[model samples]
Target: MARVSQEHLEARRRQIIQGAARCFSRDGFHGTSMQDIFRETGLSAGAVYRYFPGKEAIIAALANEVLTAVRGAFDDALAGPRPAWPDEIIAEALRRVDDVLLFPPALVIQVWSETFRDPRLAGILHGALIGMADAWAKVVASYQENGLMSADVPPAHVARVLLACAQGFLVQRALLGPLEVQVMSDGLRGLMSMGLRRPPEEEPGADAS
Candidate 1:
C-alpha cells in the first residue's frame, strides 16, 4: 500500500471537517451523530475515522481552525508599518469572523453549545482567548501611544474588553443575522470613535464638540 502524502492527508481532513461543519451547523451538537457526519462527507465510516477519531475530535479541529484565524487577524492588525485605528483593527477581526461564519453562521452556536459539556474544548478556547488577548494588548498599546485611547486603562484590560465585545458580536451576529451584524458593526465603530475623540485637555486649543 502506498502511504498517503501529508498534503493529501491534510486535504482529506479538511474535506471531512468542511462536511462536518455543514452537519453541525444544521443540527445542534447533541442532535448531530457520527453517522450524520459520515453521510455529510459521503465518506465511509473508516475513512472518516482515519482523520478524526470521533465527533469530539472533529469539533475540536473546527474550533482550532477558528482560533488560529482569529489570532492571525489580530497579528495582521498590528503588523503594518503604522498602527491601525480601532475601527481598522475591529474591521480586520470581524473579517476573520465572517470568513469562518461562511461554513455556516450557526456553526459557532453549536460549538458554544458543546463547550458546556466538553472540558477539553473549553480549555482550548480559554487558551486561545488568552493568546488572542495578549495580541490585542499590543494593538491597544499602539492606540494609546497614538493618543487614540485613554492611558488610564491598562492595555490588558482594554484587550479583555475588546475581546469580550468581539465574542459577543460573534454570537449576536450569528443569532440576529447580517442586518444586526451591520448594526453591531456600526455600534462598535461609534463606540470606538468615541474613544478616539481627544479630551480638551489633550487637544490644544480645540473647540468643544
Candidate 2:
C-alpha cells in the first residue's frame, strides 16, 4: 500500500467532513447516521472509519470548523485597524462571515443545531462563545478607553451582546433560506452597528460616559 502523506491524510479528512456536512445539512443531527455519511462520501465503510471513529467525531469536526472560522473573524476584525464605531465592527465581522461561512446557509445552521443535543458539542459551542466574547471584551475596552463605546454599558456585557447578536444571525440563516440569509444578514449588520457609537449628546473626545 502507498504511504499516505500528512497532506493527503488531511485532505481525506476534509473530504469526509464535507460529506458529513452534506448529510447533516440534508437530514439533520439525529436523522443522520454514520452509514449515511459513508453513502454521502461514496467511501467504503472502512475508508470512512479510518478517518472518523464515529458520526460524533465527524459532527465535532464540522461544528468546530464553523467555530474556528467565526473565531478567526472576530480576532482578525478586532486586531485590525480600529473602526469608527461598534456597528462598523459588526459590519466588518459579518463581511468575514459572508466571505467565509455564508455560502451554504444550511451547513452552518446544521452544525449549530448539533450543540443543542450533545453535551460534547455544547462544550465546543460554549468554548467558542467564551473565546469570542473574551477576545471581543478587550476590543470593547479599547473602544471605551478611546471614547468609542458608550459607558452606559459594561464592556464585558457589550462583548457578550455582540456575540449573541452574531450567533442569532447564524440561527436566522438556519431558519431562513439562502436568499433571506443575505437580506437578514444585511439587517443584522445594521442592528449590530447601532448602539456602539458615541451618543450625539456626548462630546467627540469626551471621557467615557
Candidate 3:
C-alpha cells in the first residue's frame, strides 16, 4: 500500500469532521449516528472510524472548533485600536458564529446538552469558557482603565457575567428562532445604561417615605 502523507491524513480527518458537523446541525447529536456521518462524508465505515472512534469524539472536535471560533472573535475585537464594550464584543462573536461553516451555531445547544453525560466534552467546554472569560476579563480591565466601567468591580466576575449573557443569547437564538444581532446589542446597551444609573433609594435627597 502507498503511504499516506500527513497532509492527506489531516485533510481526510477534516472531511469527516465537516460532514459530521452537517449531520449534527441537521439531526442533532443524539439523532445522528455513525452511519449518518458516513453517508454525509461519502466515506466507508472503516474510513470514518479511522478518524473518529465514535460520535462523541466527533462532537468533541466540533465543540472545540466552535469554541475556538468564538474565542477568536473575542481576540479580534480586542486587537482593534480601541477596546470594545461587552455588546460590541458579543456582536462580533455572533458574527463569527454565523460564519462558522464546519460547526453550526445550533449544534452548540447539542454540545451543551451532551456535556452533562460526557466528561471529555464537558472538559473541552469548561476549558474554552475559562479561556474566553479570561479574554473578557482583559476587556473589562481595559474598560476600567478608560473609566467606562467601575474600578471597584472584579474584572473576572464581570467577565463571567458578560460570558453568561453571551451564552444566554446563544440559547435564545437556538430555541427562539432567528434573532437579530442588533436587537441583542440594543438590549445590552439599554441594560448597561440602566446599570449606570443610581437606584432610587441611593439617589441624593430622596424622600425616606
Candidate 4:
C-alpha cells in the first residue's frame, strides 16, 4: 500500500473537522451524531473513526481550535509596538474569531452548554479562559504603565472582567441577533471612560458636615 504523507493525514483530519462543524452548527451538539458527521464528510464510519472515536472527541477538537484562534488574536494585538486598549484588543480578537473559525460563532453557544454535561469540554474551555485572562492581564498592566488605568486594583481581577465582556458579546450575538464589533467596542470604551470616581463623602478633601 502507498504510504499516506503527513500532509494528507492532516488534510483528512481538517476535512472531518470542517464537516463536523457544519453539522454541529446546523443541528447542535445534542442533535448531531457520529453518523451525521460521517454523512456530512462523505466518509465511512471506519475512516472517520480512525481520526475521532466519537462526536464528543470531534467537538473537543473543534473547541480547542476555536479557543486557540481567539487566544492568538489577543497575542497578536499585544505583540504590536504599542499595547492595544481594551476596546481595540477585544475588537481585534472578535474579528480574528470571525475570520478563523470554520464554523459559525453561534456554534460556541452549543459548546458552552455542553460543557456542563461534559467535564472534558469544560476543562478545555477553562484552560483557554485562563490563557486569555493572562493575555488580558498584560493589556491591563500596560494601561497602568501608561497611566490609563488605576494601579490600585489587581490586574488579574480587571483582566477577568474584560474577558467577561468579550464572552458576553459572544453570548449576546448568539442569542439576540447580529452585533457589530464597533458597537460593542464603543460601549466598552464609554463604560471605561466613566472612570471609577469616589463619592463626595469618600473624597480626601470632602467636609464631613
Q: Cα lDDT of all candidates, in order?
A: 0.80, 0.72, 0.86, 0.88
Per-residue lDDT over 5-92 for candidate 3, one digit per residue giving the tens place of the 0 to 100 score: 9999989988998899899899888889899999999999999988889999988877777787899988887899998778888888
Stronger candidate by lDDT (2 vs 4): 4
Q: Candidate 2 lDDT, tens digit per residue, 1-209?
A: 99989999888888898888777767876799888988888899999899889888887887677667667766676667773355555555566656544236666666666677889988988887788889778888888888765666687888887777766776765676544344545665577566655566685666766
Candidate 4 lDDT over 6-28, as tens digits, reads 99999999999999999989998
How displaced is residue 168 in candidate 2, in Å? 1.6
lDDT of 3: 0.86
Candidate 2 ranges with C-alpha deviation above 4 Å: 83-104, 107-109, 179-209
TM-score: which candidate is best?
4
The residue pairs found clashing in candidate 1 are none
The best-first sequence of candidates by TM-score reads: 4, 1, 3, 2
Better of 3 and 4 by lDDT: 4
Each model's total of backbone clashes:
0, 1, 0, 0
